[model samples]
Target: MYAIVEIAGHQFKVEKDQKVFVNRLATEEGKKVSFDNVLLIGDGDNVTLGAPAIDGAQVSAKVLKHLKGDKVIVFKKKRRKGYRVKNGHRQALSEIVIEGITASGAKKAAPKKETKKAEPKAEAKPAAKKAAPAKKATAKADDLKKIEGIGPKIASTLVEAGIATFADLAKAKPEAISEIIAGVRGNHVTDTWPKQAKLAAEGKWDELKKWQDELDGGKA
Candidate 1:
């Protein structure tokens, strides 16, 4: 039997005893791990497909090792600004071997609940706090790095350009966004940035992620 499962952020077709390398997992080496996001299962002539993911279906595996992948060079340049950045990156990876595939009755591991400590008795009532005007929290910039094709420099540039939040980015036109980042590097495609930011601003993460998967950098 073989199963298509999502490990880390990527999916793979795995079978018993098959070794696979995936994005770095938090589980330690030699530890057993189970993936409940089973997308499909096939056993010879019979096939079971999931509507997104099958309930109670799971793929078990053991972490064999952790390692780094080949280094990739990243170079960025800003037009006529003498701004240049260069770096190298290696993807952290984990090696694991498929142990078993369960068709049903697989229980998901529940997260450990945090214990709450007893609050110390306050001499003054909480109503006393209401007397003081509430201070508004300072708005913090959203991580634009979460958007595909937007690196640290571009994110900083966008933030400095007054497009600090996802909502701000969503309201920007593609042409305006392009002009805003014209000082920075390559031929960037900004047509999808507003769309992606809109989804993020609306808290539609899954839909945004699905759309991101289909995108090439920021291109549709």
Candidate 2:
């Protein structure tokens, strides 16, 4: 037989000899606890569900151990401004083993195991073919590369614009994109950017030699 019981503000269907992890309870390891508020019960073909909790129905479980979950890390940061933050956390948990359900809403059967006969082995099937390679994921619109005059300033503007990923940068607006790169070094230098962005959008990097030569000549 199996029954649904509420523990640690959560509901779970438990059966004989099953182990479960839940919120830390007041009971200690090796101690037995009986849940009087059973929400549902089932035996083979018959099933019963409770309104709030079943009447006189109870399920018993033994506290096996107390444990803690894996550590989780949280992080936050702000660009150029140099602001950063990080933290970690862990959750307490209890391990319990289901004992049995009583017919009179009390716990009855003893928790134990008996030897069983050996079962026959089944044949294994051949492995299936490998799936096709997935397409390259698209990145952001503000890809700094798409802005006409941008260089590293394109990257800086993207970050400042909150365009962290290529997918995000790909969605940037021209005016908004311009504003993000406004103060960076190259951006402050004559606006070689909007053209660079346009070149980037058309995949015309190979044709920029004349522009590069003119830029080199000016630097000389």
Candidate 3:
């Protein structure tokens, strides 16, 4: 019998005693592991397919070893510019051998129930409560990279600091925006960021584009 199963984030067709190399798992060598994400199973002319994943189905395997795969080289360069970068990476991998497959009747383990102790409630006292300030409704975040000076990292930083939408950025102080993204790489000029955001928030795309064409890296 053969079964299609999902291991880590990848899928594989496996059978009894078959060895497979997959993404690195947290299981130690010689440890047994079971996967419940059985997609399909076949035996002779009989076959069973899952609606996504089979219910009450499981595949068992034993982790053999963990190791790194072959290194891959990554290179980048900018044309007409003296910019070049080179890097290499190796993927962590694990080796495992299929032990058995259960197409059905493999029930999931029931979660253990925790017992909680009851606590006594305190007596209430009569007192006047102060009204809490109403919170402003949150707006959906905009793509800050649409602004000339903002790159992916800077955009992410701004979103992290609560400057998400174009309107929010338009209301932000340039000096504060500069301070917020000070740790990010490159010398970013924030002089035109608010103006660009203001134009974008006001739906003046043509004017924003024309103004951006005249500016360099958000500097007027």
Candidate 4:
């Protein structure tokens, strides 16, 4: 019998006693592990498929060893820009041997319950004069994409990082902005982002546009 199972974000067709190398797992060498994401099972002419993953179906394996894969070279160059970079990387991997396959037997793990702590109540104080009514709450967000060099994804990332408004972006440090979007694709220059945001927040559209015309993708 053979089964298709997902291990470490990758799928593999495995059978009893078959050894497979997969992405690095937290399991230590000589430890046993089980995969509950069994997609399909086949024995002779009969086959059992999962709607997504069959309930209670599991594939058991034993960790044999941990190792690194072959090295990969990455090279980058900019034509007529006197820029060149080269790097090498090796992927961590784990070797395991399939021990057994169960159609239905493994039990799902139970969820942990959260316990809230009780707080002590404070003593009541004398009442004071009432203040004026507070202003209505509204969700006001600035268009971060209006700043040159910021695309939809980068804008969303900045918003997630708490820089949602032009004022917020204007107060952000260039180093912090670079760190926030470090994982984003391509090279980005944030030297002019705060300057652009400052102009936009101050409602100087014409000046901001004029400055952007002199800039290149938010670079100085």
lDDT of 1: 0.74
| TM agreement with the true structure for every prediction | 0.47, 0.44, 0.48, 0.48
Taken over the whole model, the C-alpha lDDT of each candidate is 0.74, 0.56, 0.74, 0.75
* Residue-by-residue lDDT tens digits, candidate 4, 1-220: 9999988668999999999998665456899999877878877765766545655689999999877778888899999999999876666677999999999742222121113222111101101111111111114678999999999988877765557789989988777677566556678999899989999999999999988998888986
Using TM-score as the yardstick, the better of models 1 and 2 is 1
What is candidate 1's lDDT per residue for 108-178, written digit by digit as tens? 21121124223212312332442232221124568787787788887876765457778878888887666
Could you give candidate 3's per-residue lDDT for residues 1-220 as a string of tens digits?
9989988657899999999997665456899989877877877866766545666689999999877678887799999999899876666667999999998742221121123222111101100110111112233568899999899998877765557789988988787676567556688999889989999999999999999999999999
Candidate 3 segments exceeding 4 Å error: 106-220
Report the candidate with higher TM-score, 1 versus 3: 3
State how far residue 92 of model 4 sits from its true place (Å): 0.6
lDDT of 2 by residue, 1-220 (tens): 8888887557898999999987655455799988765777878866665444555688888999877667777788999989888866555567899999864643212111113222111101101110111112122334544333445644654553335444444444444444344334342432444454445456676765456556631131
Alpha-carbon runs more than 4 Å astray in model 2 = 77-83, 103-220
Lowest-scoring 10 consecutive residues by lDDT in candidate 4? 122-131
List RMSD in Å for every model shown. 20.1, 20.5, 19.0, 18.4
- How high a TM-score does candidate 4 get? 0.48
